[model samples]
Target: MKIWYCFTPLITYVADTPEELIIACATMNSLPVTIATCGDFGDPIQHPPCDGSSTLANITAIITSILPSDLIVFFKACKHYNLNGVNLPFWRNWFAANPSSFLIPELLHHLHKMFWDHDHLWCTTVVGSQEIDFRFVLLQVWTDHHNVQWYIIGVIAGAAPTDFISAIRALMEFKYLTEAPHFTKKQVVHLDCCLKVFHWLKQSIVDTGAWWGKGGGDKPWAIPKLELLQGVVPSIYSHGTVMQWSTDPTEHVHIRVVKEPSRAGNNHNYDAQVCRHLDRRDKVECFDLILQIYDPTLMKMTVDKAAGNFSLPDLCPAVSDHLN
Candidate 1:
């Protein structure tokens, strides 16, 4: 069976992680859990949680506490998860779905975004954007993540330290493997190895002070997306290859279904206009389909008749009179 058939896309995108947690909680009918906080600075595992509530850890028990009748635990879990009130999300009733099981790996946002936001930013910071841009301009043109991975190591060679380059290379390799249309058991093992190598070598970034974002200080590497790397293999095992469900196809359709339709409307209350426009379009398409079903040759005959009726005079009446 095709992997795409296994699941349908819902909630195309959310603005950020907080919104994602909201949706995830809503979907599961539970309160949101803030798994990004780091507590164990002494642990070698960078940003390891002191309470060990990394999103990678099973936090479903924590989320489930909000659903019970016990107001005390419910409110306590609410405060712990950083929620405003004891009100349970409306989606807790959704059957057979949880964030961990349902949220498949996305290449564009997960892998590419991580590269651009964290890794690429660090590289540019360390080696300078002008130098990197100069190297990129000289290289042959490539598109998407390939443009970044094709020769990032070669481009930044000797300028960046060996450990930094190795970490990036490991991530690039993991991304490439994840993009494969099909994977073997052996390939899965290799994928895990790539992640392990990345984790092992990523300390160089901390030592050199490249981990420069919000989760700084003892939690220099507390990136939600970076932590998401651990779940990639499990997601693939349960869902299929990452390519099967990547967001690239949805993004490609966004312009046609959303952006272009929205442009047909006035700036005010445009979303309603776009919906109305799409409804009209869908109705017209349905009519066309019904006509074809009734008479398969109708469209072709109409096109032929229209073409035959056209003349130079019809196209250019002034020029046609002169010719006559």
Candidate 2:
């Protein structure tokens, strides 16, 4: 007989920090970096007013430019950016890894969240939430990638202006392409084309006053996740696909291991209580596995008895006689 333990579920407690720190860690160069500042995009610091003269060539130049932070100059830049309350984080010395490359495409936040948060709002503004919801109800489809792929055109076609519909369709195409299980070289080029089309047509949303600007005018597409779209194809080529490193499983783990366990504990000193609860749960599971390996009947009977609601007397009149 042979037994193999394939996976051991465990949680590593990592202290959460602000977005700035994460960007700093990923790039290793720290911000006011090209990606964060839109410096590569020919946009000034803080994404100043759109000069309309910003040509396609200027826009096309926007690309991911992560430089090595190990350089002497970058150390000063890290300090300037106030990363980690130190000149450089300690992990950089020990972990010789490019996290920025690995940290490429997280589908949950990168796509789904961006869709709901920004894109959905722009869409609602363009074609009114009431009309969109009415269409969705008529289609009997939930809001998801499938909703976008199959029925989005019908949902928004007549309600939205032609350019707005086209822009959304391009974005939807790009989203589905990015989520494909595998991609050929040709598909990658198609992905790029979809993105380009979306970018070019997205100005229509601004033109229609759908997307409001911070300074009280229509804003250009300066969102981080939208910019992150540029790196999706590169990430696919470097890694297998977005599915390989999707954050969905991680989010599931958070709910099962973190949130559920925390709820089991009393509010006071719950962290240690949760840890103890998980350890006990793991031990009980392991013990059950051992029992099942040795004698499957024992484990099966234990589970049945544990799950059984009625006593022996309820099952047998003879048992009641014995008790009496």
Candidate 3:
């Protein structure tokens, strides 16, 4: 009888003594693949800085490790190998927070919940928000969240940095107004930086020139800055903040809860849609990458079903490496 057979290779390595994550790539490269190994990971292995280990870093490394057509990472996250990991307490607390209860999350959620924007980039021939010829628009995330709005401003790149004197001078031209106060200064910005963005509401001013502003002129009252976070991609900026902390190398904390029906049925597919990147066409599928400082003392991810335990470092090498 003619039979069809399959042989699945195991591309696995463990880093017990994690440094800057040099060992993982070194192993994957220095070692040779038997018939069991996959050839997608080329001769030269390139990676960002790593503080030994992290969840997101592992996830990204495996994703880019394969060829264009391979579906290993998908199958691993979706089925085969269970993720069995979670963020530290700080990150978990951050997920449950909103603008009203923001400060603590900064303390809880890995010191930062930065949003890395893979959309609205200049390199994609994508026009600036205002310059769009089409009448594209969006709905509010929540009506009650009053100050949640995008502020428009001009940005000039490749210029030198501005000192305190230049900053005040620029503000003079765009003089502040003394209008009747409807909202307090706190409502204008929800930053927990301890480094205040502005002093008052009527004179609500934002630091538009900082490297975070992406060269755009900002107002003290702009709801979301949309430029604080940075990425390796040039001309591309993210709209979020970051944090620092440590989780126990042994324990685990859960944040992403996929229901049974979701995991076994169509729910997973639905999630794949909603969490899709703003520019799905870029081949940058999802924004599942969650960065946090590598802390072996906080919490970790577990199967939560039977007997399974894993750290974020066991998964995300790319993101973890970069963030650290």
Candidate 4:
């Protein structure tokens, strides 16, 4: 995955200084990975924002300038305007197909005290067994390309909630989470298969408890999460837990890997990038587990069905720079 990060030093309120860069990083805490502050800034820097605040509106312009971004980050300056943070609703969604129309102010006020109530909404059923939950979605959506197929070979697993996905959607569609008392059908919120699928697949395993350190001796610290990753275990095996939904390998022996296939098709480079995220940032890591079970070349993931209690991550905005 190729991600481009851009920031106008002015956004951070400090230009050409370490303080400015640090502030910019602090502004972009909503997404994983570091920022490559280009256009005005040189080289990609590991930017983890300090406080939860973000310059979202100003950053939107920079993100829009770079079209076709796998992901985008921003910093907002509501403080400069003396307004509380931009009151982006908790349930608004990032409508990639229609970004501009995602939010409306009157709608925000209406959503202020009620649960989401969209009068105009449509829902689609992901055709699969009720037993299959969020984990299967990752194994299924691994390769975005049409040519590469996916398969689940080794052992079968069970369903688990991907908190990362839940967090992102909650933020994007907060306004649409409930109906605007003043207007009906003027704003609509619904599940989107394509956008939510990709968004969550890249973001699901982030900051989850399942992702622990590899034993650094003292306090076990988690690694940074990456936008892309792929892998094969150094080697392993175990003999425990016989359920179908667990990624946990209780049998003492297991293979854990996350690889990112470059557009250039260099698997080795992809592996290095994965390591950097897992080793450096201390963020949670997500790998497509099905590959260890099935062959990548033979069959492809044809029908991904999410039965019950399952939905796409972007259905609601989950992450925000509102907190530190």
Candidate 5:
């Protein structure tokens, strides 16, 4: 059986220490893990250049050590924290330099024209605020799946090219692994497009100085290291496909199902809230299963009778004729 693992902000709270986190991961079956940030991990500065904490480094090393080498791990960069380090400053400067041009209609128009001509892929833009008052761009990448219709797998904010390029590269790599044909001419064509776009974006970032630009700081600096971005290509090449391995679906469950009810009851008691959410979900699932197994036609007839429309002919003359 295939399983998908996700390390999100909420779940990370279950483990207090790195060792505990490793234990929690061990409990899960072999699966592709999508790693995101958590408050428990503390600040990035605590672990890296600033000090030798190695909280994240240790957690990830443990995860990789236990999981198979081919196991796909998706590193979702947090926009709030600037996972790449360069995002905040680069975008701050980009907005300042451009002035009224960041995420404006003109920029969006150009982006849409350049990227959305193909039917399979498209983008959506929303106006968002950052740092409380400053405005930022929220761009979402969506794909038209032959089975699932439209699904958004990536969301990138700010005007920095590195952020955009990185997000786009991940999305395209995912598409190549999940959507492309296998061992066929179509596969080659699809992969060519993916590589072409990937290279183009990387080159654009370098050429435009977006990779190494001065913004919200003293001097121009090199792009911040994003360890998550490093594994994407290799994982795709090793694992045949990354389909259904993303955290988007789990995220949707949290946002649409868990958070609201938890808040409505008692937001303060984290453990109780989680327990209640799980209980409610299980009950709901069982009810749905019961409905699925039960005959629907009987329910329809009962409803019709209760509404004083008991005549079968009134409901469906064809059914009445067949009965006669």
Candidate 6:
């Protein structure tokens, strides 16, 4: 079976440097791995002993030699480039043509401006700012083993649908190929849904000239790119399983786990922060391994659960008496 691997500079928390990460990958002797990275950074490709000339071709050749048929080296589309290419241009043209569109009664109802609650007051100002300062896009990669795993591949500072679209397309292709050699009926359905959504997105861009639909009087519309990507869920259920091939989980990791630690000291030495975090992780992992050898049960408890447990009170006296 083909195994997937992803490479992203954003995963600096895992390794201090791209070279070290590549070395670790090279040492693995199991399933063939795919190394995915954003096209923008020029990392791994532009960094280190690998010459900058013909970098893509050289990286491909090296990975191919290592895994032959099993390696998948994919360069993700650049989010910043895509923002300029698609989103910004569309929004500019549309906004200039229909400045009043944002003020439409239907749109206003959905906007934070109409919110009555004080708690939602912040939303009103943010909504207005979003139009002027549109900057937030994330690209993520996901994989599945016993459980699915996600990683933030890229986080672009712009309002763009292209990055989201590109990620979906890439992931769908990966899912299709990995499940190949043979595909279940449900897998085929899932793939079809992916294609449908992909086509719908392309068409939406063409038809609306924006990522969202042009709302009429009472029907305000906001395009839901992420929601549309969930079109694969029903097919997943039909297939009787779930896969970790989604960005949602990885996004959570970024916000809760990686981002805070990386920015903890508010220090400018980002590289040192990453290195220190990785060093701590390594030590923790090593300690866990040692514990596993000497105290397997303790290790399991530490990893999976707390040390104490309490029984529930007897629900029915008759049942409790029988057990007693």
TM-score of each: 0.66, 0.66, 0.17, 0.15, 0.31, 0.24
Error of 4 at 256 (Å): 37
What is the TM-score ranking, best to worst? 1, 2, 5, 6, 3, 4
Off by over 4 Å in 2: 1-23, 26-35, 38-79, 82-91, 94-96, 142-150, 215-220, 263-273, 302-324
Report the C-alpha lDDT of model 1 over 1-324, residue by residue, as the tens digit. 655535433423322344555645422222122233333211223232212122313235555554546667765665555443324443444443354455555787778777888878778877888998888888867635667767777888888889998988898899888988988999999998998898888888777667754646655654666665666787677777777765566676788789989888878788788888899999989976975786554445222364454234244355334433
- Winner of 2 and 6 under lDDT: 2
Local distance difference test, candidate 2: 0.58
Quote the positional error of residue 207 for candidate 6 in Å.
Answer: 2.4
Model 4 weakest lDDT span, ten residues long: 228-237
Give all candidates' CA lDDT scores. Answer: 0.63, 0.58, 0.25, 0.26, 0.33, 0.32
What is candidate 4's TM-score against the reference?
A: 0.15
List model 3 lDDT by residue over 1-324, tens digit each: 989865433222211211112222222211111111122111112222222233335445545554324555444452221222221212222333221112111211111111112112221122334533222223323322121112111221112123322332222211111111232345223222111221221121223222222233332222121111111111011112222212322223122223322344454466664344223523332233222234432225433445443434545566544433
Error of 3 at 82 (Å): 43
| Model 2 vs. true fold: TM | 0.66
lDDT tens digits by residue: candidate 4, 1-324: 999875322111111122222333322222211222222111112233222223444334345643323232222343232222333422124222111111111212122211111111100011123323343464665533221111211011222344433432342243233222322232221312222342444233323343223452332222212110100000001111111112234212222234221332345667676666556434322222332244443123233455323222332233211110
Collision pairs in model 1: 28-92, 29-91, 29-92
CA deviation > 4 Å runs, candidate 6: 1-183, 186-204, 211-260, 277-324
Could you give candidate 2's per-residue lDDT for residues 1-324 as a string of tens digits? 999956432211121112423533333322211234322331222222222122112222221122344455444444443332232333333333333433456666777777776767877787888898888888766777646546766777888889988988888778877878888999999988888888778778778788744443333544666666766777677676776665566678889888988989888788898898899989989876865675555433212356553333233355334423
lDDT by residue for model 5 over 158-273, one digit each (tens)?
43345454545543453434443343446544644554455444444334433333342322222111212222233345443333233455556767676766676765887787
